[model samples]
Structure formats: C-alpha cells, structure tokens
Target chain A: MSSHQAVREGAKQVVRLLEKFPEEKFKYLVSFKATQLERFSRIAGIPLPKKLATEVPGENKTSINEIKDIVNRTSGPLGLQKDMLRKMQAAIPHDQFTESAMKDQITALSNLVNNKYKNYYDVGDKLYKPAGNPEYYQRIIDDIQGKKKENILAGLRTVFMGR
Target chain B: MLKCTARKSSLNTVTKLYGINAAKTYNYNPVSLYSTTNKNLQADQKKQTELEFDTHGSPIVRGQKSTIPEYKLPKWKEALGEYVIKTFGLDMDKIRAGPVAGSYYYSICKEQGLQYENEPLSDSAKFFYEDLKLPKTFSQWFQITALHEWMLFVRMRAMPFKYGRNYQQKLVDKTFSDIEMRLFDEMNIHSGRIVDQYSKDFNSQLKGAVFAYDVGFYTDDTTLATAVWRNLFGGRKNIDYTHLDAVVKYIRSQLYVMSRMSDREFALGKFKFVPTKEKINKLSAQEEEEMKQKIIKKYEELDKSGLLLPSDKSNLSYDN
Candidate 1:
C-alpha cells in the first residue's frame, strides 16, 4: 500500500482497535515498563488518550500512576468509563500482545485490518512449483473478464427460487 | 377432506395387499423408502414441503431452538395430517442421522467450498443444484459456510444445557479448523502461522461477531431489523430502511426454511447459502394464487393414486 493509504487505514485501525479490544486483556498495558510505554506512544504518534499518561522520555521506571489515572477517569457525556474510552487503554503497551502468546492473534488481526486484497500473486508465494499458481492466475483472469458470472447467476437463482 | 380419507383407506388396502407402502410409514431411509409405490407422490411431497415447512415455517420463536417445541397436531386433524406427512415422504429418522457429527472431524476440515455443486438439492429438482453459481474462490466458499455456521451458532445458544454445550463444542471446532485449513491451502498461510496467528484472531472475531449478531435474534423485530441493516449493509446513510425490511423478510424466509428441514436435510450439508438481498419480493394475490396452484399440482399424482390423507384435496387447508 502507498504511504498515504497506509496512514489512512492505520488511523482507522487505531480507532477500531480501541473500540473493540478486550477490556480484560488491555488491563495489562497499565503495568508496562516506562521504555515500552514510550515505544507505544511513538507508534501511535500521539499523546496517550488520557491526560494521566504524561510523556516521560527514557525513564527506566515509569510511575504506575500513569495508567491508574487514566483508568480512573470517567468518560464524558456518561458518568461511567464505558464505550470507546474504556477500550482505548488496550492500545497501551503490553508485552502479552506482542509475545508468542498472542502472536498468531496479532497476525490474524493485522491481516484483517490491512484488508489485504486476496490476489492471484499471493497464492503463488507458497504453492509455486513447476507452473506455480498458474491455475489460480487463470481463474482470476476468467473472473475479471466475466465479472463473476457464476456468482451473479447464483445470486439471481437465490433471489427468485429461494435456493 | 373427504378425498383424503378415501385415499387413506385406499392406501391401507394397497399396504395390506402389496406391502408397498411400508417404507414411507417407517419415517426412515428416505432415499430407499420410495423405489415405487407412488412415484408422483414423492414429487408432490417435495413441493408441499417447500411451502408448508420451508416457506411458511418460522423460527422456534422466543426460547425454542431450531424448531418449535411441539407440533401438537389436533386429535381431529391427526389422521389426515399424518397421512399428508407420510405422503410427502419425510422418513425423519434417516435424515436425523445426517453425516454423523464428528465422524471425520479433522479430515472433513475445509470443504472444497461450494461442495453442494456435487450433490442434488434433493432427489427431485435435478436442476436445483446445477448452475447455483457455486463459489469459485475459497473466500466466497467461506461466506457460504459462515452463514450456516452463524445460524447454527445462534440456535445452539437457545438449546438445552447438555446438548447445547455439546453441539457448540463440536460445531465450533469443526468450523474453525476447516477455515484454518482453507487459509493454509488457498491463501497459502503457513500451517504453523495459522495456529499461532490466524486461528487466534479468527476465534476472537468469531466470538465478537456471534455476540454482536445473536442479540438481534433474541430481541424483538425492530431491534433485529436494525442489527441486520448495520451488519449487512455497513450502516450506509444512502441505503433506505426498506432494504433493511427486505433483509428482515429474507432472513425470516430462510429461517422458516431451516425450521422445516429434517435433521438430515440440515446436517447432510445440502442447502444453498449465497446472499439473497433482492431475491424475494412480496407477492401479489395473483402471484400467490399461482404459487398455490403450482404447489397443489405437485401432490396431484399422489391424490390420483389414492394415497392422499384426510379424505380428499378439497378438505386440505392449502393456506392458513
């Protein structure tokens, strides 16, 4: 993807990740090392969502108060810290998210967020032998030329006949 | 009704003299149940089934799972109704055996996707399976399976404790591995990576989606309709609520179809699953009459053969 597209998608991902991330899983982020927290801030390229997480450069020991303050803060327009405000903490630096424990989960989620187009070229990466994924390549060409006639007919049948 | 009674009596005579009607009465082994006896009755039963069970049937409603709790056929209606069900050729027992839930759990993983193209929709309607525009790609195939999986998962939630838990474990495991395998084979993700990455993410999303989606099923119509709109249409501002209304109708239509299916019909994996966004429309009186006539004709062969239930064609309630 172009840098511009990546930036746009990445911003959307951040919003979604905050909205839908597991609350319990993200609680670990509050206990992150001072350096790890800074790394997260750099990646996000923004100040921490809540004011309690003041930027501390290169400090070996970041105060746990940073996370505690944010978690304690109430979400506006509602007395409770619910909705987006609650889950944004999940974006905080947490070792468990990057470790092998959640490694597969990260790749899967990242791929989903990337909306990586399922291309003909990708299939050839692993299945490349003599002809590679030539069959897949041909199928893609057929699909593009025909504009997926098979699916269109399938849709028509489903509509009219309730198949 | 008189016509059905005459056929019922006549069917008994044939049974006593020829032992020909034995199989359908047993409600087992639907395929072998009808080598002869009444060829046209089989066609009639399928058509009637499509209407009574598939078209008009609704979801279990409220807490019922998969099917309504009990049919409670009225005493006066029993003889005729039984005859109708039998004439239609159900053999509910055989359909129940299905493919055997865990027979080849690991091996059955990752269907060739559009695998229905290989089987007929039923013994009749030879053309039904043909030209379904089966999913050509793995992802498209995933969508088909995903729809069924979602429906089944929702139903499982409403099931009784023991069976509900058991079905949930078995179905979820089978579905996930199949999807994981699809990623490995078609998308060519490394097998190792699939377990470490894709499976974990997929599981989380599956849980999130199920929770988000099933709420609509458990709630009232308006909530369900809105949920359907947001999920299916991406909550686009330009799309009208009429489209959502159509979707709600289509969902009820499919659920009605599911409620009507025998266990074998469901578990045997022979149903269609592509999206039907604009497929079904509200029918006019003329069209309604036309549909009724067409369905009625399907049973004519059986009626003429004197196997119809109750007493006759006129006695039957064609539309309730």
Candidate 2:
C-alpha cells in the first residue's frame, strides 16, 4: 500500500479508538487522545495523518462488548497478543476494573495531561509551571487581587457616569 | 516537528559526552544475573560488591562529591522528632503520603536508570544501560523512571480515591523537582530560562508518555513495547527483542507484587522493587487467600485496640 493510504488507515484506527469515549462527557479527553495517537503513530513507525492534528468528535456509542474486547485486541506492528489482561483483571479488585472506574481514570488522565492541580487553580497555565508550586500559588493570589482592584475601578467609573 | 529534531540533536551531544566505548566499562554478564538456580553465587556476588548510597539513597557516582550538603541535625533529635510525631499524631490534617511517595517511592523509580557524567554504573543501572544496551543519557534515565512510575500508578489507582490521588501527586511533584535540581546541580545549566524551558519540555514529555503507557498497559505488550521503544530507546533501528522482553517482564513482576499488598501497607511505603536478577512466580489460589486473610486479621487487631487516632485512621482496605 502507498504511504498516503497507510496514513489514512492509521487515522481511521485512531478515530475508532476515540469513538469509544462519549464526546459530550470527554470533550477535552478525545482531543488529548488525538495528539497521543499521533505520538503513538510516530513511535510505532506508523505514518502520521495530517487531518487528525486537531480535535475529532466521537460518537460515544461503544457497546459493552467492545469495551470487553479491548482486553483481547492486538496492536502495533508486532501484533503481539496481551493474553495476561484477563489475569490482570482478576488480580485487581472488582471495584477498580469497572466501567465507572475506567471513566474516573479517563478524567484523571486528561487532568494530568492538562497539568491541573488538585488544590490550586490553574494560574500557571501561561507560565508553564505546575499549579502545585509555591510560585503558582503566589500567581493565583496576585491574579485575584488584581481582579478586585479592576472591579473597584469599574464601580467608581459607573458612579461618576451616574452623576 | 522542531522539538523532535531538537531532541535528536541533543542525543547526538549525549553520545559524544558518553563515548561509544562507555558500554564496555561495566563488564557484568546479564545472563549470569538472570540465573535463578545460582542463588548462592548471586548472594556471594552481591556481598562482594558493596554499593554505598548517600543520605538521599541515591547511588554515589565514583566517590564524587555530593551536590547538596549533608544535614547537621543530631541523630538523636531526628529520631526523637519522628517518635513524637508518630506517638502524638501531631500532623492531623494530611496523611504522610508526601514523604513516603516523594522520597521513598521516587528513589525506587529514579535509581532504575540513573547515571552521571564520567561515573561508571554499578548495579541496576549497569543492567539497564549496559546489558540491555539502552543509551546512557539524561533523557533516557527520565524514560526509565517514567516507566516505573507508571507501574506504581497502576497500583496507586487501586487505592482509595482521595489518598491514591494524593500519592500520585506527590510522586509527580517530586519527579520534576528532582529533575530540575539534577539539571542545575549535576548538569550545571546555569541559565534560568534554559532550565525553565527544559522543565516545560519534560512536563509535556511526561504527560504524553504517561498517557501512551496507560494505553499500552490496558492493551497489549506490542503497544507497551512501542511506547518503550519510542520513549526509552528513542525509536532507533536495530532493536533487540530480548531486551524488550526483559523490560515487559520487569514491569509485570513489579505490578504483581504490588497487587497483593494491602492498602495500609502500600500507603505506609512498604512496597519495594523486585530486583531484575530475581524471578517472580505467580501465587497459588490457596496462598493468595491466606495472604488476604492474614492482612485482614492484622489490621482488624490494630483497629480493635483503639490505638489509632482520628488523624491516623484510614478507611482504605487491608484486604481485597
């Protein structure tokens, strides 16, 4: 097959993977997965498809069987089967392997990708530092104080206009 | 695209820094280390080579001077403080996951592929960089550390949500903090802008690597190997199959050991990495049941004694 055709096929596979998650619930997650898929393609020696460089909406119509079959699927150039998935599932607690748990995992993964902190607001988004840092907290405080000053000035302007 | 080329060029400099003959400097045989039958010989070998670590548990590279100065705190005072903290439960608001994950857990992951300039590797680092023929570079070490961190992530996910998430955060925070320090202290990158750029680059790299490895773990070895090749091996041609197999086995073994640990045990930082030299065997059904029961009984007795303060109380499972 031509490299162009191969790239298309790879893109299709990636889209299929993204479709497993509900688009409305995981708007940001699908986008994260898209970029990750491109990286995976590069590493696996698969062609990169230019069309999938941005977000792709998913149908979120994945059936229970498809989720179950995820354990049995083979991927990459080697096409090696991971027969130990069933065993791994059994080793872990039942609550941890459930669909709901998997959803929690999806949310957590995206949060990590976005570099969101559990405690503080994401003020370091522009600075590219982690939100957990002391410097980040100072930024958050400064941002709030700046906004308060702006609100006071606006209030005074409104009062003057009324006069 | 630009970032990819930049990394490739950086790797070229690394290759120049650690010469091609660097691999031959450490002459340990990989196969001999893997021989399970030669248990006595292995013990003797371990005794023969006494590896010393600094206060931080990081392996001292070639009797090199420590980058940071040692603490001057008296041993008795430190021990007294620890005893008082444990006995009185002075820290009430948060669990001790910070010190456990940040210090203990981070050390376990970092030591796997750690290296320094002009210093010869001794133990596990030698196994990975020499026997496995992985490139000895700073970025390569980050990949190795990231892989192990992912394994811990799998287990940490099984923990109760609140505590588990905290542990993950602590580990993540420490990993980057350590990297930043290493860059400044060890690599001597004096410029703040360059350090910040490196930190940002690493943050993104880590995010991408974690997501890719998560998919691979939930999927198959091929995907996992692909992640490893891309991140650890830098997607070079002329790969070794056995090396990949060894890594997969190493990951599986670590995960299996962690799966059986009770939440309290894990939370208290009881988990240790299984040495690559040792083989891991699956537990029998009866053995697993007994192990679970034993953990339950121990925790139950502790609960019955009413010795734990509210701060020390944990709702996480002692058995599963």
Candidate 3:
C-alpha cells in the first residue's frame, strides 16, 4: 500500500481500539488516537476520516458492548449500579433487545467476566443510550427526511426548470 | 378844637396897641408864652404834613466793607503738601531720597513748583516705591526695574514649552509614550519616527501657549483657551493623532455604508477635511510661496473675467 493508505488504515485501527475500551480506558485511548491521527495526517497530507475519530452509533458494536459491560459491573457500587441499569434499560431498543433478555445476558456475563472487566459495562451503558432510544432515533429520522425533502425540491427546481 | 389857657399877666403889654382891645389879655410874661407858642406850633406842624424824608443813609451799610477783611492766598507748596497728605496719606519722610524726593523737597522749601504739583502720586507707582518697601539704594531700585522689564520680555517671547502647555503637556507626554507601544500595530511607522514626530509637533504647537496667554491678557477669548488646551494635550503628539485615526476610520466606514446605499450619493457627497492651524503652519516654505502665487494668479484671473470686486485687488500682495 501507499504511505497515505497506510496512515489511513492506522487511524482506523486506533478508532477500533477505542471502541473496545471502557469509558475511562477509552478516554486515554482517544487521546492516543488523536496524537496518532495528527502524525498520520502530517505524513498523508490530509485530515483523518471523521468516522475514525467520532463515536458512530449502531455501526460501532464493540463500543456498545463495552459500555454495557461497564454498567453491569458497576451496579453494586452505591446506587450507581441501579442508575446505570436504568440508563441502559432506557437506552437499548426494546423490540431488538428486550430489557429482561439483556438483564439475563448481563447476569450470565457477570459470572464469566473478571471484576476488572466489569467497568466496561458502565461505559457501554453511556455510549448506547442515544443510539438505542426511540426518541433519539425518531429525531434523527425526522432530520434525514427533512433534508431529503429539501434536496428533492432543489433538484426539481434546478433540473426540471434548468435554473 | 384847640384848648388854651391864657394868663392875665400878658394883658398889660398889648393894652396900648389897640384901644378897642385895651381890655384884652395881651400882656405877656415872655417865658410862659414862648413855651406855649412853641407847643402850639409843633401841634400844627404834626397835623399839616402828609409825607416825611431823610437826607442821611444807614450806618450798617456804611460799615459793610470794613467788617470782613480780604483773604491772602496760601503758599502753593504748602497747599500742595496738604493736598498730597489728604489724597494719598503718603508719609513724605520715607520718599525723601535722591532726585525725585529732593526735587519735591526743594519745591516745598523754595515754593517754586506749580500750584497743583503737590497732588498725590499714582497708586501703582506709589505702591511700587513705598508699599512694596523697595530697597532705598539706587542699585536695588534698578534691579527691581530690570526684573519688571525681564518679565515683560518673557511675556512677549514665543518659546515652546519642553513638554506641553500647563496641565496638558504632562497628559500629552504620557499619552504619547502609551501610544508608542501600539504605533507599530496600528500605523506601520517606526517607533523612533513616531516618537520624534510627537516630540517635534508637541514643541511646535506649544508655542501657541504664548498666544493663549496673550489672548487671555487682552480679549479674554475662549477660542484661544481651547487652543491652549489643544497645544498641551490635543496636538499631534497627544490624543489628536489617535482621534484623527478614529475619525479617518469612521469616515472610511461611513463612505462604505453610503456607497452601499447609493453610488450617486457617494459620488456627489463631500467629506470635511479641517486641517489644523498647526498643520497649515507646517506646510513647506515652498508650498506657502506656491500658495501666494496661486492667490495672485486667481486674482488676475478674476480681474480678466471682470469678476473681481472693486478694491479687492488693490492690496493683494501676499504676507509671508
């Protein structure tokens, strides 16, 4: 591959690594990613892709899972565990993943995972809230529809009328 | 109606004169009859006269001139001394020195001066001489006069203040130093150039302080008062330069806005350019000469066109 393509691939790898880490772990990972992107951009003579730097919903499954794990692990610490569970409950799509089913899966994961790995559930809870919520998804859909309508009107005026 | 008592002793004297009246009482004792006759004559005089007359004038009228004697005039010097004493209340003994005092003394002693010469001296002169208690020595008096002369000399001198005029000089100096830091950021002039220009303009304008002082002394004109303030703090070295920058910026911005509004308006519009007297003063000597030439040329053009007013071109020569 060319050096530019290599830098682009390297920036993508850093984004993947950040997605897998817990919230606190991901904070350090994001800082590292930023530095790496800066170096890559300097070598490639172009900015890093926005997808590699930003937290993208639905597509970033690894980050979603990490946040879920953090929420489940921190459930016993004061009322933080309950709050995280409630936030996660509101976050995950009920039709896709029912709360009862997710709780059963969490219990099963808690038995399997070490205590150090549990913090990822807390991070998972925060990251997935906006993605899974019906209201958040509805707003995004509305925005897309509005933009599409505007584009259609523009296209009709420009193309059909030759304006 | 007269009542008379006749004595019989008077009957014997006239008995022989008239035999028919021999029995009449014509014999008289001379003393009693004489007295009676006088009385009867006086009474008849009193009854006959209707008017009376006197031949002599009054004694008081005769004595009028001698009662009050003629006045002799007092000596002029003595009168003058009294006049001075009353008018100024000056102590003659203190001023009794050198020529003026000696002359006055001689006039007093010899009584040779004019009648009105004893009138009081002027307040200012007297104050200087006596009230101020100037030294009696001639050299000291000369020194005081010299000081007064020097003060007058300085009053007329057109010298610039080192900093500025009055309070404004200090303010200008401070503002200039402050603006020195921002000079490079704003205007692109070198710091040294800015400083030098500030100093030069500041000193040049400070010469107007004398004009202000003169205006104050004479006409009490407020325009010169503003000029004094401008000389001190509002000149090129001071806030005026900064204010000029602001004004230029505002004018430029206004032109931009007006241009946006209407191009025709922008084309026809005029912006005021009030050049300060100091700036006018600083025009090159050649420029001033050129200005004079232009004025003369304009006058000639007007004359040729028959537009020059009568007497307008008569005294048209340019001053420096």
The best candidate by TM-score is 2
B1-320: candidate 1 lDDT, tens digit per residue:
00010113323332111134443453333563365777776665453322111212222222223333244656867677667656886543232222223222222222323333333243211211222222244434443344445655443333332333444567676667556655665466766854567677666655644544444343323434444434443333222323344444445555444433332223433344324533433455597577656645654555577764432333222221
Give candidate 1's TM-score.
Answer: 0.30
Pitting candidate 2 against candidate 3, the one with the higher TM-score is: 2
Candidate 1 segments whose C-alpha is farther than 4 A from its true place: A1-163, B1-144, B156-161, B229-243, B261-320
- Tens digits of per-residue lDDT for model 2, B262-295: 7778887889898778877777779989988988
Candidate 3 — which residues are off by over 4 angstroms?
Answer: A1-163, B1-281, B304-307, B311-316
lDDT of 3: 0.31
Clashing pairs counted in every model = 18, 0, 21
lDDT of 2: 0.58
The alpha-carbon lDDT assigned to residue B25 of candidate 2 equals 43
Q: Which ten residues in a row have the lowest lDDT in candidate 1 chain B?
A: B1-10
Q: Rank candidates by TM-score, best first.
A: 2, 1, 3
lDDT of 3 by residue, A4-48 (tens): 465444434433432332221112112323433344344435555
What overall lDDT goes with each candidate model?
0.39, 0.58, 0.31
TM-score of chain B of 2: 0.72
Candidate 2 lDDT over residue span A1-163, tens digit each: 4554544454344334433432221122223334445544553356555566322323576643565478346452134345655544443333212334333334433333222221122111212222222132233334433543335665586456321
Lowest-lDDT window of 10 residues in candidate 3 chain A? A120-129
